[model samples]
Target: MSENRAFFRETVEQILADTLDQSRIEASERRMLPAALYKALEENGVTRMLVPEGKGGIGADIGDSFAILRAMGAAAAPGPIVETMLGNKLLAEAGLEPADGLIALAFADDGAAVLHAVPWGGGVDHVLAVTPSGISLSASASWEMEAALDAADEPRDTLRGSLGAIVALDTSATLRTAAILRAGQMLGAIEWTLARSIDYAGERKQFGREISKFQVIQQMLAELAAQLLASAGIAEAAADAGRETLIAAARSRLGDAADAAIGIGHQVHGAMGFSKEYALNHRTRRLMAWRDDFGSVQFWRRRLAGGFVTCSREEFWPAIADAGNRRAA
Candidate 1:
């Protein structure tokens, strides 16, 4: 890792270690924001990491931001961390001042009347709406909110309101940006699951021996480790390249990795993994919740397939080669 990224990761890890805990994570599960944790993030300028340096931010690279997000996922840090970081950048790009407190993020469709599954819609006072025309900020009071939750029991409310004032900007990149970042989160959660499961296997007893000694158990963990490495590599590439096709592929591949984590991790832990009180359930459930965010696995798979389906036999190889070269560049 670069010096800056290593420092960035250490800082995020410290903030999370200091401000986030099991109790706070449980409160978040019940739909409450970890105010202290977010306050620490804001106080440290972590929330504004993406905004340009000219606009009161450190102007950190996407890799730096991705490392923080991956750490958040591993820790299961609650609230709209990703949303706030990206939202501040959007606001700065539009020459608007940075927002305090939490900000929900949504990409509104053309002629869409309501924004659905908005992350932390009810908890946050502001929403950053990115559309084909422009990006805009809308106050929470202007909208009627319908309460909802994702698989992890985190808020994913719906909102109906005007987008307030629109700021002209190219809004095409938001979804891809969100997708690759969310994929990083998913990768982190999967990593947690695999680590927890392996540790448990080593300590768990079966047939007068550690379960980890069994060939079956060893194979399962080995497979999960392989999946984690693959997901981590692709996710890093997607975050670095920011290509729509690469992001789609990364999200789709990570979906399978998440499933493996949930299945293998739970199988290793047996009944303990299913308990609501156990820590493993937290990361596993989040894997289910976040896998579909930004875009569903099926949706991304279809998107990736669409890119290749239109090519002839002669053109397919070159298209694939070009994509790889572009991503490498």
Candidate 2:
């Protein structure tokens, strides 16, 4: 890793370690994020890492930002940090001021249809509509609550928007950006699940011995480790390449890893994991939410298939070659 990247990762780890209060995460599971927790993130520069130095930020790169996102996911802490950072960049790109207070993003596929899946809609002060077409800058004050969960208890709500008001942002590139970040989040989640499961297996006695000594438990961990490593590699590769197909592929793999990690993690923890008190739920629940946040494995799989279907068999090989060459450059 680059020295800067190592430094960035260390800083993010420190900030999360110090500020990620378990009570705060548990509270966010039932209600909106606590204001004090948000303030801690902002004060620690977690919220402004991506903002340019000229714009009162530390001007961190996307790699550094990914490190933070992964750390947050691993901790299963609550906030709109990713959404806020992405929104700020989008607004700056279109020559507008950033939104104040908590920010969230909602997806819009149709230019004229109102999007209903505005994340954290109930508590967010402002939300921007993200579509394959463009991004909206107009702030919506009134949000009708339609609470939904993608398997996690974190707040998710619905809202509508006028697409015409949005600027014509690069939708393809934007999707890649979101996919990469989501992949990073998944990586963190899987890492936590695998590591936690191993620790639990070692501590939990079964058949008059530590479960970690059993072949079954060891096998599960090996599989989990393989999945985690694969997901991590895919996330890093997607970031390094910055290609839509690569990002979609990474998302697909990472989503699969999230599923396996969560399942194996809970299984290892047994009844305790299913209960409301265990810390295992916090991280696994976030993985559940993240798997479908940007695009699930199925969603990205279709996207990846479409890319191949559009290209003739004769052209497919050359396209792959060209993409590899571009990455090598």
Best by TM-score: 1
Candidate 1, 1-329: lDDT as tens digits: 78998899899899989988888999997888888889889988988999988888889977789988899999998788889898988899888889887899988865466999998987887888888988888787778999999888899999986667678888778887888878878888998899899899989998899999999999999999999999898789878878877888889889999999999999999999999889887898899999998889999888777778877999989988766333311
Against the true structure, whose lDDT is highest? 1
List, residue by residue over 1-329, the lDDT tens digit for candidate 2: 67877787777777777766778788787765867657767776666676777776667767777877888778886767788777777766666666667677776775745666566776777777777777875555654566765466777766653555667777656656766776677788788888889889989998799999999889988998998888788678777677667777788888878889988998888899997778888888888878877776788878766666666889978866654233211
lDDT, candidate 2, equals: 0.74
The all-Cα superposition gives candidate 1 an RMSD in Å to the true structure of 2.0
Candidate 1 regions with alpha-carbon error over 4 angstroms: 325-329
How far out, in Å, is residue 306 in model 1? 2.2
Q: For all candidates, what are the clash counts?
A: 0, 0
